[model samples]
Target: MTRTFRGRVSRLTAAALLGTTLLLPSSAGAAAPFPYQDPALPVATRVADLMSRMTLDEKLGQMTQAERGSVTAADLTAYRLGSVLSGGGSAPNPNTATGWADMYDGFQRAALATPLGIPMIYGVDAVHGHNNVVGATIFPHNIGLGATRDPVLVEQIGRAVAEEVSGTGVDWDFAPCLCVARNDRWGRTYESFGETPDIASSLTTIVTGLQGPALGGPASVLATAKHYLGDGGTTGGDDQGDTQLSEAELRAIHLPPFQAAIQRGVGSVMVSYSSWNGVKLHGHQYLVTGLLKGELGFSGFVVSDWNGIDQIDGQSGFTAAEVSAAVNAGVDMVMVPTAWKNFLTLLRAEVGNGHIPLSRIDDANRRILTKKFELGLFERPLTDRAWTPTVGGAAHRALARQAVAKSQVLLKNAGGVLPLARDNNKIFVAGKNADDIGHQSGGWTVSWQGGSGNLTPGTTILQGIRAAAGPTTTVTYNQRGTGIDGTYRAAIAVVGETPYAEGQGDRTGSMSLDRDDLRTIATLRKAGVPVIVVLVSGRPLDIAAELPGWNALLAAWLPGTEGGGVADVLFGVVPPTGKTPMTWGTSVTQQPINTGDGKTPLFPQGFGLTY
Candidate 1:
């Protein structure tokens, strides 16, 4: 049974978890506990008392979130910053589970040393299973999970992710990307569950999984609904580009998922870097304040995207005007990343000159502090090593494998070529993705734009096939599909796009399989064996012209860290049930295709063939 992580641990446990505080203030423990530090007080009462004790500088610091690389423990003590975050691929030296916990403890100690002793919060883009960690269980991306159409399974993945994240002392996750991906050409198509609001909204179960029915549980990590408002419906699938939809279209297409997230008690909402109709979301008061906070009744803090405030003025860098606009628009915490100091200085001036109001600052602080108290961060500010071993545990990996298998969409199994015979058969597996773990995991793995060639620990698809094959069965693999003379019973060509994320992943040009993949499959075809083309991709590729030549096709959308799941379906151990999360394009010209758009797709949304 799952443990309820929101139960606040004792102060002794928190101190033990924190270990020796090298930077504990010289006057530590001399004063009595403040009203805000009392565990029995109401959250509102505590937040109010904490606000009373804080100075103007401390109040400003509570709203600033700095990137880990740009700030240190000493800086936290001096600036009294409220939060810190590890950008994608950012980690401390040693970059292991213990290293992360130690780094977090160091920072917590500094924050505790301050006059008010307001514990700071740490955040990460743990979108796909604590991805920054080298050996964490990397679950299938949102598109793959979306294919499963199982909200229960998504919630389970969320719980596992929260456990892994908590083990590393990260309390916040910028995940459950509820963007209703309307265009396959968008680089972030995989981040969305499906091309419709229903799919994304259903997966809000992940919020419950992360938060564990309520906040401040044994392994709870606050979940975030990201890139708020129309990031997925961008013009030309352009990342951080203009979204030309009207208010009605926007409310219908993109707003439902956020509503679901809020209902699930999601602790944070990330402002999108993209614009709606022309106005950037980071500075949109009517939407952020009036719609999200006022109408939606969202009490959680609104965080800015990575340097998202900087783009509000359509400029190269953030300015005083941008700071004022974002705050005035109801942004509680500014994620300025490297330029946090500048943000603090400018924001302080903005408040002094009446450009930004005091009520807004207090409201933002109240929202931010309430969640911190609700999360029991004030009581347990350090890593509980008990959860550390769960980071890449066997159980989590098994769950990831299950998710991968469920996510596999059997697009084509013509002539009954699937469910390859397990015994007395010879299989030839070829393609760049078949043997590469990094290629299958795709972007947002250990790095920002995920790379190929043994990036982390995980079984490759070819490895899974070999492991799943019967003792009598023989499996052979070649990267380029060479040396085949019809001796094999079947040729499995795992081919698709290489690893990419966000900006680089957009398909403004042709969305066809790369030259290497085409050549590899073509080579396999010449051998006269039944060809099985498994697509390891972030989004549906334009494979209409090539579909006729292949005997079988499986849309394996970037199954992360586990390849055995692919073999589970291939060898008849698991039935294929996944459907297309996004409309599969026949050609690159159908860039913004969706359900009811009237454009003929190669495989319409929800199209999947089972044996």
Candidate 2:
């Protein structure tokens, strides 16, 4: 009787196996479902199960994120690090789409090789359309997009950014910077959408579009609302400056966009590199723990910006103990670009000694896991490989072209010299930016501060002018005032900030014009020629000091890669609709002005007088 009963059970088990095989797709033959989550089980139940099975080492590893090159595949298995990220401009072996994919796949494979087989999440800035990668569609900086005041367009841009980023297997974008820029002199002014809380909040819908549905859907790249809690309100409009604000002011000014982002289910919040009222954001338990997690009920994981944790002690050097302190302060992911071992060893020692609570570790891991699950990473272990067809494809370029065209604001069209004679006989294009890609791209392009001319293949303003001038327009280019002839129909002078970044571009409260630029503009003006000044800069220079010399002025605020786009509007192929997103103050004294300050900006925030 026992033999007969065993035989019957074996037969039934075989029948059930046959039914399961029939249920799955034939194309999905022999594929193993990701062990992290089973659709047959509830999401919460799956997360809990995964957490329960993880060892203490695994849990701690889940709470940390290491840079890509800091450790090899062997270290990933040994340490079982939960995430890996490419720091700014950190590319794969070749920096191509396939290169990014291969790098991501290799790292993920290593992490999954551990006993739990959990995949590591990869992240990049993708701040302006996967910008670190060569040939990716570089869009207008956030400030330019703010001028459109079109949240829908911003969302569309976000969607395109998501598609391109995810195409290369990246799952997170540190973007939709919700900074209400208080000073134009801030080098990172281009990164912020606007100076008002409303604009920041409204424009941040890009987060929703990028992340997609909370449950599960395509186009689901995790969005991070970054540099959290008063990054823009720093003293002297400083980069990483101290923001001394009343609690009410903090809540009213900086907290709204975070709140809005949270409501939209933003996947993560990167702690600011700056301090709030003398408290370092990376070490501020009151804000990171009490406010962000407790009061605001943010369930998303908190990440530290690049080397942000190290800056906590200010003058004091960062040690393992200090890193552990910042981790305990509520940073789920630490971007220790060069010191992964220090973070790992210190964190483990802290956990062992009870300096860091296991509950905190669990909470951090859980938050990250929830985001991964929300991203459907558990279900779709592999990204859609077919995204290659659309990565930096025509549609993205078309949108980038549109963004470029609209971002051109006609600051001045005096004597209607611009929309210059389309059939002009000669147009002299003078300045470093005439044939330069890096100068036009400004900060955060190919390199951190960007380079000058031909760093990448794109039409420079000179190229566009030449293309639009047809066969008759003679274009002359010179760097240091040598290539000038007596007469030309019009001279287009492209001048402004060369190439710089935060702290490097820090001014003592004035937009000092480059003396050489002034000489060039003045020289051209005195040559008995019509000179059109194209100011290419991150901040609005106090051009009133210099504008008296030029016949027409165009505020082309660092139009990226596509300098030809500027000529598109300049020669009347496209009309300039972009108004000044940030106020172009007449002078430094007229700054810090908003709509309600009872004093009008030299040009109101929405001011753009077009021809």
Candidate 3:
């Protein structure tokens, strides 16, 4: 499915393969040094040399990625795992940057203990700035970054994220989700850049930043061009649901981002859990193998989403057929998480039965091992702690602040109500998202389905507002708009969706503000004070009916850690420049509204009001 390869060195052919002039097994039964161990050798040559010496068990291990919690250090060596990963919220005991580094080193040591001594690659959902670690700098989600429409800034953020991830010894980042979010109701809409191939394609600059000028550069992490094709265009904005589209439509809307990503030398491509035309993507040979690999010439290894192969047969757990189908479909490495052992067994059985050819295994190994060699993992396997200090450091936070500021979309500023003067400004902040760090950070912060309260250390929007307000200004806050009046210059209501990742975040029903938000706005309106509504959400909420009652509206789409960016714009330190990445619909009825769509939008794509 990947490609045809050259002949391999069989165990019996080992002596015949290398010329007799080369060093042979000595009288002491010790062997000569391998070419694969030499750093000067080419990556393909090293991969070939290594593959020649590998057994079937070792080759299978190279194609498997196990979760950190499920696979112990001993298990790593026993299985000879090719990769280790910390799933969202799956962290080490201390959970600090150093703790992560120590954990990564421990696993590396176990992996090196194997006969082949192949160093395992570690991966994380560092989608938004080493999000699993507590103190790592958290950046705005993709939708927010898309609103900024600044690929250069996004690339800078990607570099910062790569550095932070490197500090934790995480060699791979499953990030820069290039999904062209077509529907507002999709829970992962925040993960997409915008509702077009062009926006997503432009943002693939992040892949370059993540991988550096080339693979193995300083702080360079293996970037993944994710959920491979047509994840964001699913019917009804479903999570892991069918995307019933003709091949042409899929290629036009969804394929371009991946094309752009591959051009940037993205190290891997993660297959989507969702299906296309009722055929699951994990098992879609035409798309994954034929289109992505053959047509597009994606030489990098293809990876499966978290247990994505299980859905190939529309079943709860994966079967041998699914395993063979996935491998035959060109999924080089599988993210088995907890079920890695079962997967290894099934894959071995499948390979033994000839369902998955040995050549496919070799191709998978060659692609994966080539990256490992290119990464210089064999030479520098340990965590590079030099970049450790930058995790959640001031510089990255400043960049995040700038990004957050740039991401602020001012949808409505009636009578120029924003740029609220800092000095002598009586700002009353209220609503659920005002002071909560977890709320501001949104999903994929410390956990998969990110939560509220102080889950990690970062500035909340209210904290940012107070700091910006300074000593001369008076700043008051409440969860609800209990105490606000015309006496205050403006009542800032920071209200929107709480944390939700995939399935739970999907809003099949009305996409309007919750009752709590509506009630809070009513309470603020009751005070007869100017209401400055700062909506902190992943996607645009249906707020046309409520827009008139508010004095001003700022779409602060899930600004992570550095909430001060929102404050910077609010107090005129930074002018609002973010444009709407997606069209804002008046009501839930206009569900799939976009730039070219026939339905009238409340705010068209790229629309933004600037003072």
Candidate 4:
């Protein structure tokens, strides 16, 4: 059952008892604007003063974020919303770097139309490079980077992501996912570093890389420590189901990375879509308020997940009253990709009726404004053209190539059979993802849940292999993993899961070898030829049941767009040094084992046998 808090402003003894100056920051003494003043300035005072002048409508606007094309500048003025975001697929018409910058400027043009003229902050996922825009250099997914275990390399990657993203006028990045993925069955596991807090903490080198010591420093892109608490530890390994854990378990396992990120001065945080126990995280006051805000001392604004506020009341329970409850529960901004007007209406009524205290509203607004100020948005409201050429230049792609090479974990290379003959006259490349750029890029690419076929500009493994082998080698492509003649010197099978996002791909157990996959592997193995199995998947599966028959194994972990990079290492141009970011279970039954386990994983974490 859900409870709703509804009361009018006039009868609120909560505010009355506090004082008429409820919204005012606490005085350190008498002249002090706040008990804990912003070292950056009495900027809190400026924010407080700004809040005093805003109407209920404007304050509601500050708590809302809309997509780029979903609404226009007119909508911003009409609703007085504070922030704007571009989801995975959302982009300008042409979808070029300059085109995206112009598109962003156009949206801000509308958002600043209000009486107070506050500029809207733009945000994007950019999980693997500035992936939304075409021609942007797509990097290896987090799971791949986790294997590198080089904090300095990860930090450089973060800086590269920021430089590219900021080139398009975007300031906020919802990245450095702190979730220690305890289960690979979760679809978003590839987004996480590993199943240990220490690994996740180390990968959070991006926090320092994104937000520099001062602000506006190179590679600084307003980092967000996301999906607060245990987003990766849901019941039955579901994406947004109940995460059953004691408070102690939650803190020990999940809270440390966020604390570490906070110490690095991460500029923002995004709330999780899952519930902690029985209550939706969006509506949970204890964690978002008492734990993150009060105890952890997070001054950054907490943004909601995509349409996460609606989950508060459940699918059938969305109502005006419930919307107000979520807002008061410590959600500063709502990612209302649609139906934003309803949020504004509910928030205005709640504020006027006194269900939400004015002080709470001020607090939320101040947090949002503080990030904007720290980003130096007030001084430089627009992006310069100087960074445009650097967006996806040759140097960036070189870094991408290095990332791809380092992230490919060679699981098995029996008898040094790999480093296959690139000079061979006949080479059989069979799999759906081998030549397909979209499949190579995986989720959050050109489209939200990454489409099939070549959606972006990049060379596929087929292309890369051909390039490396010169004109003499004949490469045959098969999407269905069939038509293996075995007449060739060798065969390369690139097979894995298709693209998916969040709850859509969430699964538990039963990651077995399919009949089709088994057939493909068997055909190549029986051909009296060497088979190089490049397994590209988000989660480590039950490969132990089927691996003894293979000549070589490579865990590519969703290598994006540049399947050619995989080709470079496959043919002996570069040695494979990448290790297993997560432990591979021998079977489905031996799941959830960490590094400290006495028993061995099929391949333990940091296990890489280089030849």
- Taking all chains together, each candidate's TM-score versus the true structure is 0.96, 0.90, 0.95, 0.89
Clashing residue pairs in candidate 3, if any? none
Report clash pairs, candidate 2: 436-453
**All models, RMSD in angstroms:** 2.6, 7.0, 6.2, 9.2
- What would the per-residue lDDT of candidate 4 be over residues 125-231, giving only the tens digit for each residue? 98888889898988888888887787888888887887788778787898978888877778888888887888888878888776655555653578888898799
What C-alpha lDDT values do all the predictions have? 0.89, 0.76, 0.88, 0.76
Runs off by more than 4 Å, candidate 1: 1-32
Which candidate number maximizes TM-score?
1
Best by lDDT: 1
Rank list by TM-score: 1, 3, 2, 4
Task: Give the worst 10-residue stretch by lDDT in candidate 2.
Answer: 2-11
Off by over 4 Å in 2: 1-35, 214-216, 480-486, 589-595, 598-600
- Answer with 2 or 4, whichever has the higher TM-score: 2
lDDT head-to-head 2 vs 3, winner? 3
Worst 10 residues of 1 by lDDT: 21-30
- lDDT (Cα, tens digit) per residue for candidate 2, span 1-611: 12112101121232242232211211224332343435455667768888988998888788778888787878888888888888766787687777787677667657656776666788888877777777777777887787767788788888888878877778888887888887776778878877778888988879977876553466568899988889888888889999899999889988998999989888899999899989889988889989999999998999998888888887645776667678788998887767777777888888888888888888888888888766655444444555645666778877876777787788877788878767747777787667787888776675667777666556677777778777766777776545665688788888888877666766665586777888887777766788888888877788776676788888787777667778888888888888777777778876665566676566778777665
Candidate 3 C-alpha lDDT tens digits along 485-555: 78988999999999999899999998888999899999988988889999999999989999999999999
Q: What lDDT score is found at residue 565 in candidate 4? A: 76
